[model samples]
Target chain A: MAHTGKILVTGSGIDLTLLRPLEEAGNSIVARPKLLSAAELKAELRDAVAYLHGGEEYASGDALSTAESLKVVAFMGIGYESFVDVDAAKERGLRVTWTPARRPDAVAVFTLGQIIYANLGIRNRLDERYPPQWSAAVPMPSELSAQRVGIVGLGSIGSRLAGLLLTIGCEVSYYSRTRKLAETTLDLTYRTLPDLAAWSDILVVLLPENPSTVNIIDTSVFARMKEGSILINTARAALVEPVALGNALRDGTIAVAAIDGHYRDESVNAALMREFGPRLLWTAHVAAHTRQSMAAMVDQAVRSVLRALDNAPDENMAVGQ
Target chain B: MAHTGKILVTGSGIDLTLLRPLEEAGNSIVARPKLLSAAELKAELRDAVAYLHGGEEYASGDALSTAESLKVVAFMGIGYESFVDVDAAKERGLRVTWTPARRPDAVAVFTLGQIIYANLGIRNRLDERYPPQWSAAVPMPSELSAQRVGIVGLGSIGSRLAGLLLTIGCEVSYYSRTRKLAETTLDLTYRTLPDLAAWSDILVVLLPENPSTVNIIDTSVFARMKEGSILINTARAALVEPVALGNALRDGTIAVAAIDGHYRDESVNAALMREFGPRLLWTAHVAAHTRQSMAAMVDQAVRSVLRALDNAPDENMAVGQ
Candidate 1:
């Protein structure tokens, strides 16, 4: 039988204009605006050549087993392992690809913005009706250029942030799995996590979440940080222990912090919000939600689907092919 | 009679440690932690060879005539014209010097911080407890690097900000008194104020308060600006017309704005605060209040006093020597 050339898009809210390139390539789109059940996804996969996964619905083993024509499972985001059953897809001889592009810049820029907001004491002055009374007792805020910035991970986002910090004349250091020799030319120094914490006036956490990485920034790391230093975490919240973070904020081990990603538990957020107030800048995981990044990821996901359909998947983005 | 070597400091809260350089030069420091009256200032100036003029007290012509040994009026800040009688000082052969150093970087950094704060929609997400619901209807925020930044003045602070913006990959343009030949090499474009407003995604007001510059950013400029554009003013409050700014915010001609300086009138602040809540990020004139800048200015002021005492004044800082 000839190919149907149908691509199934299962997401609550995907921009149709971004899928124009896929349609222009002579493929028909079967878009399910809301997340579908496993049985519904199985039925939709039977006619489609590729599935554009939207991260809400899990592509279960049963769904993969039922698909007759589906060659690829293209995830719109980086964390494909959580949504797609890799072994099941491999059993069905299907390619699983994800878009891991354009997010590093988005997250890095937002992290820098938060760092400045904290360092400049913008929160204290936010609600002041009158002008700040300049006095000897009231200490002045330090300049961004004069700060020593230590990044926890030397991944794409961390390295990009390090470069941005260097441009602003900040002393940049990192604590990664291994020291990057090439980055030394860019004046990046490698340090142990504890030492990085001690030396940094601004410690930024950007590590990926894994078994070993989860809760890595605990009480020990907080204890080593400079008094009145800032902490900026744009990474997963699981990397930082909530109890340790709350203690650090309470005892003044860390002067201020801005966390982009929050805990899954509503009670934890409520507790943190009630206890810390403006000292902690907590936000939902929206650091990588820029218009530029969204458009780029969507385009990359579509390209990944098209490439997989042609039996030539991108090695960087492919998981189990 | 020999020189008294006495320097009168007339700022309410000047850091004495910053004035140690002057003391180490065999000078006796007369620290008056208050804004003195003209009669009180004249009485204090009779014995002092160099007067460390603070911004608060007005050095009138009557006060200048009373000074017997005062050779230099070393203003601790840039705006000497507001505090010192230049014609009176010039007639008495007294050198007037003001510290105009180190503030550009301070103000520029703060301005960049506010720009990022506005651009990233941090204000919107600041109070959001739940994760943002991503949908096609909800528009995404633009990346800072993708922004076209239009600077109202290419003076010290504006030029420094333009350079900082360039390092982050922003398209920078300026409207100044005259086109800068040297800056064009750095990829800075010269535009008319209206053209700049129209082209910019972010408009920064950095002009000094003068007859020609005051109220430069009025209704017409706001009308020319891109819809949903951000305005950041770290300069004088008078430069931006208050009524027009309120109107722009009300009608949504501009999405958000961050102003560091506030008007003198209490009623104006109260009215604006009541009307535009989070759409405006208002702060006192504390953008240039960094520790580094403060120390540098105090040291510069001391050096200017020392140089004038030796009959060798810094020509760059001298007004009417």
Candidate 2:
């Protein structure tokens, strides 16, 4: 076990102080101060046995062609969809891993907040009430404990969120690609996508953005949702059709929509704001921005790379086949 | 068991159906459609043995002098301070009660939401980003699990909120008039107001508003609080000095303030908004406005009156000495 391997950290703005644990473990660190092209990265990758990756560079094709010694590449964030070419890495026999799924606790709490915010109509109240007209007749919000909440994704974040909602006595149901066989013991009911949409008083979207999920919730899904139901999206904007959502909110098909993520284009935000205005509550994709989550993600990424370099088995670290 | 007592319900907008539970128990119901004068209430009080009160007409001296047969008076909502004259009720041998202690679970969840909201700087990020300038360099919010949270009051709502925060792994401390005897087993430390302010990265105000609590969090307390700390108030607006809070937020003494309650004045809200628009996250005092809480309050108020009429030794239900 007397190995001094070179671990390359790709991308800038990473607080290198957090990687102190890796350095103290007797690894030689090579960090790229800026994002490099495939040609530039190949030279650095040639000698490094491990890499901590953050840039949007596709890692399998030309990027990994010269990395003869490379055994592992660890993505620093939860989502590795467009950031890495996992199939190519699999083909090359290189281990690939991503950080813990979406900082489960942070996202879960944020999801609960969004649910409360939407059901309570806080945004509309904030917008309309400059000097909130004191009224006992303020609309009574449906209790979280009394309503049926249906989640679209039941991954780590969604599962944790389901537990939180259950703690508040919400009747929880979820729709995933497959039934969560491991979590059958939880107090969650499994339903088909359309059934879930139709049943939910509040439908939460937590599915990761992927080729199969793009525009998954459109006019059809909106039409199927219960009348005056709410929508909360914390996962990705690509999963929802903004135009359809805007119409639903305006026509009261949806009572409210609390979104923390949007399409990468600024125009989408502008359009949503223009159409929905105060009917939409926005947070800047900050569900996973907690200091603890960020630190844990980096620490785990470093550990995964170290585990790979030492030939230790990592059943959960590797992302795809 | 043959009691055909008359129960008078004061104030407008009380759902008549909630009183059906009392009527089913063989009580005749009388509801005041609007705020009544002392003379009007005296006439209603002549026949009524139990009362559900809402209007601010003080029940003291002359008001209680006329309520000859009134054995119990229940405040329809939690706050009973300015609504009832406790000394008068006690002298007149009448029991007074208030319903649903801020819906402990509802307020606890809302308090946690405010902590996360303030710590995450959701409003600031929303104001600054359009479609979010995606960056790994996003400001890292202090983790809820990693920091110390100081609560100003550890009553039902605060005690429940402390438990919720503890579940999230926060190091919790509090400053109450007296240490909560029941919560000595909880992982909470009792601290002086100044010490709690100095030690906390997030200070929560849940104190019931009284003559003693008004303007308790003045400039001196703000000075004692840790720099970059956040404030959350779900209790009362009078507890915080808006001018001082605005100054702290503007000067960066406090990073953010999330408030759910405020002084019922248009000018105060306008002034606070004009000073710290984005930094002050506002929720319209709807923390306990859930349908579940509302129904529970009404149900409990009815039950308390029934219990009082039955000659039951109910010490806690009677609020005044």
Pick by lDDT: which candidate is best? 1
Q: Per-prediction TM-score, please?
A: 0.83, 0.75
Q: Which number leads on TM-score?
A: 1
Q: Which stretches in model 1 have alpha-carbon errors above 4 Å?
A: A1-16, A20-73, A79-95, A133-138, A306-317, B1-14, B21-74, B82-95, B133-138, B305-318
TM-scores computed on chain B for all candidates: 0.81, 0.77
Candidate 2 docks at the CAPRI level of acceptable
TM-score of 2: 0.75
Candidate 1 DockQ vs. native = 0.42
lDDT of 2 by residue, A1-321 (tens): 734568888754456788886778788888775556777888888888888985544465677777788888898765666556777787788888887544677777767777876777665555234223334545567777788999998888888888777767789999999989535867688998889999999999998766788788999999898778989998777789877887888788887787876566568778878777666777656677666776777778877877787778775475533
TM-score of chain A of 2: 0.76
Error of 1 at B37 (Å): 11
Candidate 1 lDDT over residue span B1-321, tens digit each: 224488998764366888887778788999875557678988998888888875356788898897888888988765576568888888898889887765677888889889988888687687564436555434678889999999988877888888878877899999988887636766798899999999999999987665677789999999998778899988877789999998888887788889876675667877888888777888876777788877787878888887887776486455654
Count clashing residue pairs per candidate: 0, 0
User: Which candidate number would show the highest DockQ if scored against the true structure?
Assistant: 1
